[model samples]
Target: MANVAILELSRNCAKTVEEIVKLERKIFPKHESLASFFHDELKKKNSGLLYLHVDGELAGYVMYSWPSSLYASITKLAVKEQYRGQGHGETLLKAAVEKCRTRKVSRIMLHVDPLRTPAVNLYKKYGFLVDTLIQGYYSSDRDAYRMYRDFDSS
Candidate 1:
């Protein structure tokens, strides 16, 4: 594992959005974040954007939203193609879970393409169970699995 730091991003960090977009393009070319999208998310009180820096370079990011205190939803998770398999993804994910815990969120959930076996496996490793199959969740051609990890905060 490389020396990685998980940093929360904000609108004040002007370059952060560009770096995140570049990493998104490399990992998920089909879905890149627009400048405005990042801008809006940063302005939202309920949203979080965290990036994993390996050796001080942008390596990956995980974005999530907690609409209420009861639940948190992971909106995005991506690791640079070259940096995959180095535990960056897992680190980012666990960090998100902790964020939710701190917020007193009872459940954390995310949607994943069924084809992304590695991601599904990682979620399972963190005790996420398949909650349901969402038809055409991503697109008409793509289906998704709604995974959930419930916490016993009591």
Candidate 2:
């Protein structure tokens, strides 16, 4: 998998709102509208993501939002369910961090469902701090933990 290809997607991929919304639904079953995806919710966030492919097939993806400030945020990170535990998620995350570092981003933050132990553990391994958790952070259906990491400025 050392030769796996990773591509940074352009803003426009011609994907239908329905298909994109379907993917979001997998993560947030109470899924919001696609309108919010490009507007109000992550408006200030300029997405910098990489699609991970192994053996020419989609393995995983990491989507992070670069704000061009001292901090950045990861909007989403997921590996196809069948592909979990193979380190693809970690690889995707490292790619995101590398991209942020290259762009001079010093801090990165992300929200994950508190009950998602595997994800929480993976993030902890990557040095993210448990920043804060709002009781109803995710939605009425789930609670989320906000994790953060700030890198050395030098």
Candidate 3:
């Protein structure tokens, strides 16, 4: 694994949005983030968008929103094809977890396609437990597992 840097994107950073859009297209064509959406999220205080770079090249990104509460929810997590299995995904997730802790969130949650075994395993390894099965989460043909990791076990 290479030394990767994670950056919290800013609204004025055009390059960050461009790179994120490209990576999103490559890694998740069905769920690509538009430039406008990136701009909006970057401008908001309750939302966060983070990108991971290896030697100045964009490798992956993670987006999450707190939505006026102490609950953190992950909107997207993606790594370029070439960067998968190189720990970038886990690194991104760790960063998100830390952010949630910094914001004093009670829990971090995310939805993942049931068929995405690797992602399911990764979340489980980090102490995330399946909360429920959401039918039509992505679409009528797709189902999702709602997973969460709570900071306060009590």
Query: What is candidate 2's lDDT per residue for 46-117, written digit by digit as tens?
Result: 666577767766666777877767778887787777678988888888888888777787899998888989
Model 3 pairs in collision: none
The runs of at least 3 residues in candidate 2 whose Cα sits more than 4 Å from the true structure, single-residue gaps closed, are 1-3, 15-22, 32-45
Model 3 compared with the native: what TM-score?
0.91
Q: What digit string (tens of lDDT, one per residue) describes model 1 on residues 1-154?
A: 5677999986688788888877666565364344347678778999888999988899989999998988999989999888899898999999988987888899999999889999999999999999999998877888999999999969
> What are the runs in model 3 whose C-alpha is more than 4 Å off?
31-36
Q: Estimate the Cα RMSD of every predicted model relative to the unseen true structure.
A: 1.8, 3.2, 1.9
Each model's TM-score, in the order given? 0.92, 0.80, 0.91
Q: Report the lDDT tens digits of candidate 3 across residue range 1-154.
A: 5677999887788877888877776666454345446676667788888899998898889998897566899889998888899889999999988987788888889999989999999999999999999998877888899999989744
Whole-model Cα lDDT of every candidate shown, in order: 0.86, 0.72, 0.85
